[model samples]
Target chain A: DPQLHEYMKLDKKYRSIGFLSARTGGAPHVMAADEAVKATNTEVVSIEMARDTKGGAGHGATIIFAAEDVSDARRAVEITLEAVEKNFGNVYSSDAGHIELHYTARASMALEKGFNALVGKSFGIIVGAPAAIGLVMADTAVKTANVDVVTYASPNNGTARSNEIIISITGDSGAVKQSLLAAQEVGLSVLSSMGEIPKSGSTPTLI
Target chain B: DPQLHEYMKLDKKYRSIGFLSARTGGAPHVMAADEAVKATNTEVVSIEMARDTKGGAGHGATIIFAAEDVSDARRAVEITLEAVEKNFGNVYSSDAGHIELHYTARASMALEKGFNALVGKSFGIIVGAPAAIGLVMADTAVKTANVDVVTYASPNNGTARSNEIIISITGDSGAVKQSLLAAQEVGLSVLSSMGEIPKSGSTPTLI
Candidate 1:
């Protein structure tokens, strides 16, 4: 797990979106998110002009927030996004346009670190369960060692068990299909190893 | 606009994710581009178990496709998510174990129509230019009659000196801020206008 500590060292943040409703004559302002707001650095707000006129009743606004810590910000973003969409049916279009910001603190740190990482690096891909030792080491290698790295994971990594982790990667159609197959392999292996499957379930799964 | 006629209808044949790839591989197999696939789609795909470990020489494969399409697919899932952040390095944890196939379609003629129309739709978005009545009617009102429609152009709509429409929706933090504000207020007004802006840009510009 300590190996994973290195991978986790990279600064990460979460984001959220929400819609705020004006109470009759009430002014338009973001609803208080309480501790969650403090935890995440929320920013960028948009009002759903469509919802603001339903029955010509009240005004609605959509807010986009970015937070400092990741898990908190991610939760905030989810809550905001869901709330706005549920309240405004027409809130789904990217046509409305979006604005994203990299705050000074985060931007400065990334610049300081990114350039150093870039200077001495060569291209390479990081494969395995994202939490695996190999991946963490590869991330570390890519960072401090000037190695360009790409990280990936399989369904076998118990990803199906938790919603806490999010993985992002790039691959071709063949690579994607293979990734799906690999995930299947990992999942089956886990099921059998855990004795959740009957001996009959062991039809000798295919590669 | 006739090019976009087919997409207006609900079609089932256009349901494969690996459509092109399947053809290229000479494999007739097609995976349903169901809700689950859409939910799981990402800009990056990683297949850790299928890694070709030749001592890190071509150890991994990275393929970059059109970022716009990738962004579009991702937006479908995230819906109204705001401030999306992808660090230079982060693992794309997978959930193949929990994969589910909730929707399916083998093939159909209707899908081909929809695909063609969808392509045309993009073209419409580009040249319609908000001032074109035919464009606005075709876009905001025609295809999406059930939804509220709104459109606007800057330079006070008539101050521009050029024949070619220059529509600018900036993505930079500052520009994004201004554009979003304009979208919200103008959108609300349009909904209230109730077809006040003529279906045709026949009102000659004073500019």
Candidate 2:
């Protein structure tokens, strides 16, 4: 029980990065874990899988850990897989199972830092003609994202000409990057006018 | 069960990061989870704490997965915490216990990449005293570090004079900044060579 208590502390202290999948004995073993292991300066601890892929004949679970730093996080994943293979008896053994994992530092870090950056930032999009509406759709995405950017366009002089748009953004560097990327994607979407446009905007941009 | 099965699948996917802690009645609970719960995501099937913490406290249990992905992993942690909270009849209650959860991308990608980036980097040092030994020491550090540039200088003359030593280094450009910093620290250790004179350098030119 004390061991459990310590494990909980280790679990609580480190950050988790991604999920992994494996199969053992025909049963599936799916696990989500952090990038680090819990232990004293020199001790090793095992993290049990939370969601075991069961019923089909699989055994064992994938372990995940969050590294203290980027380098450490990466190392943790490698070590965990090696440990799994050792525990299950073979990397390619059908009875031993499989391991699948993913990295999301950029996405995870951005989400965490981006939300805080989003506080109070505001903006709007302008729409006039149907083509102008497309720009509006694009602008909506910028408004909701962490970056504080706004975009708009002027309608062409002709009766049915498209619009020329301008996008401007302001915020912390990371948030600004996210906003810029989002805006660019949406802007492109509208300019291309893929599929049928939505009502009003008819061609709203996807986030 | 089917709904739980679906939820479990959703939970097993994706990278998830969170923290854990102890709650009332000694139960364990997840403190925070990101993108764990969603309308169409997998539901958490159960929550189990590690029965051991190595030398600390809390419950210990591995998570078996139904599938693996970022979203599924997030859900597993969230649902486990929720279940614990429900059993304890409170949210954020201390009686349950604590376990931080983190989802990493892959096991192999965690440690080796980071380690590889740290070994065999460049180093340098400077000493203000004319101590041949100091220069020798600097050379040793440079070789040990396996770096490209190792430059150091001592005072033009020898007087056992106390002077500030400035050290600078440039090398590999591929080592971790921390490792480079370590090299710098090593250089500092040899800067004055324990006030010993060189064993083979020619006597200083008399001014």
Candidate 3:
């Protein structure tokens, strides 16, 4: 509880935030992250290298920054982008595709939650498909075990066409393992059935 | 700084984290979020309503939670999933297709960055396409104004096929506006040229 209290206080301090994501990874990504930090008076929150399930490679990296205000955060993002382009223009094509910037006037619940999860002691994750199937999996996972549901999302990890879904849970190691197993059963079933769906001619063909 | 100190303390407290995302919105999503909280000794991190950019509709919501340990977090996720399914089976298909869960053993840099961005004062965003084109746009935005680039991504908003890219920046109202305008010019250019590409005869034909 005291920690939670501290978190709340921290949440209030950096009322501005910024997120940068690139589709490619490696040196450019690292350089960009560094530039962002140097560009403004902000703290680096995260630097994540996203996996590419389809290509079986590193898809990209997402960098997050916390700034004292929106202006500083914005400056950081701009500096990083420019710096990345200047240093690694060629890599830009593969890495610098999806870029997003969002700012809030107050503490963001989503960010706080993400931070809490990051500092957590234990965690579990489940990835599946067909959004609907994932829900079923999550339901089973929770029902069969004593765990906490962190979050779930569709088409995560750059598997947009795959329709894959992901579910995350946290708890004691035993509970997490039990929950994951239960969820895996559901995920595997869905994955197997996915291939069984009879080809429907009605599927739209993009011209 | 005091707030940040508090945040660090709080971050140390919750060593386990979890996340759950549902594709459907409204009652089912809300119900699941509530259930997860009630089922465990965890803190709610975020509840987000996703926007369906491609389909032009509401995608659903995502819930994040923090717990004292992994076991509690896992339990929370499980409870929430079951409750949502029991109450809204039909909505599950539309909203629950994408489910994901994740856990961490220690502090997560990514989560912290996300939190910082979320709490920022003000921000700007740009969504473009073809990863490379997005980079060009990012360059233009930074070069044209005194804005900070928060983040950017390719084929954003779940449109893996669409190849749409998104970019975000933050700064003073004037700078944000200027940066967005500059980026928009690049985005429009890319969008316009997208249709002029000659179709290849060898394009795969799905039966």
Candidate-wise lDDT, in order:
0.23, 0.29, 0.47
Model 3 residue A107 CA deviation (Å) reads 48
lDDT of 1 at A178: 41
Per-residue alpha-carbon lDDT of model 1 for B46-72, expressed as tens digits? 111111212110012221111134444
In the range A86-115, model 2's lDDT, one tens digit per residue, is 322211112222211111222221111212
Candidate 3: CAPRI quality band: incorrect
Best candidate per TM-score, number? 3
Model 3 segments more than 4 A misplaced: A1-127, A130-136, A145-207, B1-118, B152-167, B196-207
Cα lDDT tens digits for candidate 2, B19-134: 33442222223211112332224333333443233312122333332323555655555565655433332111011111111111211111112111112333222221112222
lDDT of 3 by residue, B1-207 (tens): 122113213455776656665433323444455546645688765544333222322234455566778998788778877765553421211111211111111212222333222232344444333456556767788898887655554445433433434455666766766665666555555545655532212221111
Candidate 1 local Cα displacement, residue A81, angstroms: 8.4
Per-model DockQ against the true two-chain complex: 0.01, 0.01, 0.03
Candidate 2: stretches off by over 4 Å? A1-46, A49-54, A82-207, B1-207
Best by DockQ: 3
- Provide the DockQ value for model 1: 0.01
Docking class of 1: incorrect
